[model samples]
Target: MKPLVWIVALAVLSYSTISGMVGHDHHVLIIAGATDGYLSPCGCVKPMSGGLRRRVTAIKQLSVPNMTTVIETGGFVKDSGRQDQMKAEAIAETMKLVKVAAINYGLEEARLGAGMAASLDRLSGEALVATGLGGGAIPVKKFKVSGPFLIGGIDPRIEQIGAALGSKLEPIDESVRALTDEAKESKLVPVLMTRGDLESAEAIAKKHPSLRLIVCSVKSSPYDAPRRVGDTLIVTPGEHAKYVVRIEWDGQAFTAYRFFDLGPEYADDKQAQEVYTAYLARVTSEDLLSMVPRSETDVFAGSAACAPCHAAEQRVWKASAHSKALATLEKEGHDRDPDCTGCHVVGLRSVNGFRSRAITPNLTDVGCESCHGPSKLHAMNPTKHKLAKVGKESCMPCHNTEHSPTFDFDAYWAKIKH
Candidate 1:
């Protein structure tokens, strides 16, 4: 009886010790990634999700004071150019304001070259992390809130832009091995940030089980829950700044995880709005609207030109929102912005397109020729130069999923039917 009693007491003691070891040092992790040049909602669509302003608000609201740590998974902009460089810089500034701990140097960042990359790192408060690549990016970033938490970033397509990167690229597997080994040696929890799909991230996770968390850009819908590959947790911040993932860690493992959509509920942060306003001011000051590469079009005979023969059609269009497109931008103070003007006005993408309300007053707004095709010649000849038939495909250029998520051809056409 005494031996059995001792065995039971020892089992209870071991259980209590194990429970004590799993400490409850609560910490919050706020992650944003795969922004892809969407600094803010295009404003063409109402109640839109995504924007740097809303992101700041979301992070501020969700953050847990000193316990919270912010990080970005890169893919900040979709393309490379002067505008993209400006966007990257603006993103870096916003990240610095949030005190983001680390940011992954993804393919887009690499394309910007070492000079721009280094500049961005400085703008981001020196939070850039790159494991396999170079250029003002640290191989690993260490955080010491609960303890030492090490994070490393890898761009899987390193070889694709190796020359542009201006540094010898290490293999992805080698980079992961180094990060994991260092974490093990230093007794720190390891996190990896990667740009690509979840499958590739999971493959890396399976190879390096020591990686505790992998924040990846899934490039699609945000995952509702973290997917587990072995003992490691794989998560995503979603694409295009539409969502951010929050993870609550209790030292040993994640206690709570959620993907918060940056919807209308998250109001725009004032500082972030200031950053965005400054960006717009740059766009306007630089006259980027004129710099846009224009395609050569035969003619754009404005909406009024059609009113002579097709008075009813012109009336339908005037009654619809298309005619008032420029007004919307005017109200928002984005009337001069190239990004918005291209969609709001006619011929902005053509040499003969709308230049300004002063230069081409006739071309302002979504004109008759916008959907029906440029028709100065057609208006003159009438019978010989017939107008091409317009269809639902005509609207798709601006009415894409990102701009008009609720667009229905039937419903919309009904409203503007001639």
Candidate 2:
């Protein structure tokens, strides 16, 4: 009688384990957004994060076999220009290669106009989805998982800037309702992607309680943990591709969440490297650096003239990293990138500013004139050209929250005090 009871207990336990395995279908939802056309970090700065190459390595590692779905909130580039178009193509290829389930259209994509957006959507294998301001994008995209997952996107700014963009704005509430209704009828879990920070997403959640998840782009840090409002889970994937957010689902509610920082830990993907190399080649071929708009400004005298007047300041500048700013970009093979050159060199946005090492050798690095407001006239005639007193604001052009996150004015000032 004891052996019989033991056998029954063992059989019951085995059945329970098998049933649980069959019933639960765990999935990981990976979110990335606000790339703003950053393919890789400029190695000029230390502890810099983000890049498509690093993101690929992260995705490959975090992905589970047939259980991962990647998506982006939006904002592909900073503006709609020739170079921006090229960036969009490169980003589309990268995301498509990673098998992204859906990508929401942000203000930057909308600025590209409907036709250009459509071309990019096809280039990305039709992964782009937009609501309210629709052209070629689908309102809601369905991904077949355990119970089928439906995703949609909306941008509030599309309506506000429609006049300037020449775009037709649709009703946001209607679009949300359509997505909610479709998911309800199909018995699928609905998710809405938005680029309008937390408050806007919370408003949407309040209006449409059917949305189980809202992946949003925030103005704050990307590493902010996921928050719950009623039944909806709002997740921020960070900005400029600095961080990737992951959420775990067990065919019901979110089980876990984590933020993957794209730092030095991950290896750069070979394919992504090829893409970046191709982008740089295009920028060089088009001579986009020369094409960058320039305003006629006070001439820069270069650091040599400053040496005669202020030898002590010159020594400090040379000893500091500012003297070798261009060298940092050169080491990373980004010497010709216009986006980076502006910060590394002196007066890149001026007519007499740094063009190339050959053309503007004196202005190759962050010269004294970069912060002193181009002291060419001052060097020529000190009496007439009085130098404007520079303060903490002088460093802000290059040392803002994005490029230099850990910058402390007084601490940095101490190093180069003149």
Candidate 3:
């Protein structure tokens, strides 16, 4: 009886160890809309959201030992200029620190033109191992991970400009093929892909029946929520771009915990919308005004003008960094240099001795008109004339490093003391 008891105890201990090693369900963290290097209208000098620093911190907090995969769902370019390239480099540096697994190109990459896109791609490939539904260690076919997973890099959609520039786009199917082949040999499993190019993603799943795929795109519709399409778990982050899909892959099955970016609503308050609106108004007005002109033409007039009618917004802007960025440039002597003036002084042109007075009164500094196109008609009749907002591509002309090395998102935003 004693001998039999010992044998049973040993068997149970061995089983427990093995289960802890292999069958101990996996925890996968999926991050979407990682626009690290991209520029946004909220402020050109400093990005309001999706910067690399914040992302690194977020990833570190979420990382676990089992098997962690961090997937960056593209949209990383802000401008085509050298500064944008440097920003991409900065993003790459951040990725290295965070130990990201893969990255997918977003529409912004396409707008950067093929040359810039190729350059960024090369940089990322060199810096981090490309892993996705089709390119990394865990291939889409029969891939599995024990726990803690992070996958990166899977961009299929070419930006409109990149398409027009005749970039040889990578088909989704080919990318998936590469991903699956690599995964078969790697210890990691469970692949991730960005939004767009849904057709190719769908086709890949159809061809490979064993792989699990997670799709993330900006324009994702709620209708595609948590559905199984040919062995792929097509989960969309929905309207709230900031969300984490926590998945636990037990030995026999996979379960997921979806954390959506609903702001502070989890506290049971209906003020989420109001808080968001107010925060946006503050960030835009303060941060934006600081970088561009506020009263005189250039970048400041339009926003300033709009503020009178938008008194609430104007109050918010008064407390933001946009209203302070110009002063920082002045203190740094950036306003004196011709190269720096373009970005610092709003309407400061690249032409020799570009004077603010030479341009229209409204164009004296960085204002709404500088980005949103001419607002003269729209101002006259809030509805008759259409007001066109500036596209993401419009910011590159002055934001790139060709102007100055100090032109970074975090550093610039930090300068806004208010």
> Estimated TM-score per prediction?
0.89, 0.83, 0.48
Which is the leading candidate under lDDT? 1
Instruction: Record all residue pairs in model 2 with backbone atoms less than 3 Å apart, i.e. clashing.
Output: none
Better of 1 and 3 by lDDT: 1
- TM-score of candidate 1 versus the correct structure, residues matched by position: 0.89
Query: 207-233, model 3: which lDDT tens digit per residue?
Result: 765457566554432332465776676
Cα deviation of 73 in candidate 3 (Å)? 2.2
- lDDT tens readout by residue for model 2, 214-262: 9888655554467878888898888788778877777788756767677
The 10 consecutive residues of candidate 3 with the worst lDDT sum are 262-271
Model 1 ranges with Cα > 4 A deviation: 1-24, 134-147
* Global fold similarity of model 2 (TM-score): 0.83
Q: Choose 1 or 2, whichever is better by TM-score.
A: 1
Candidate 3, superposed: residue stretches over 4 Å from native: 1-23, 36-50, 105-171, 181-192, 195-204, 220-225, 236-245, 251-253, 260-325, 328-418
- Which candidate do you rate higher for TM-score, 2 or 3? 2
Ranking by lDDT: 1, 2, 3
Of models 2 and 3, which has the larger lDDT? Answer: 2
Backbone-clash count (model 1): 1
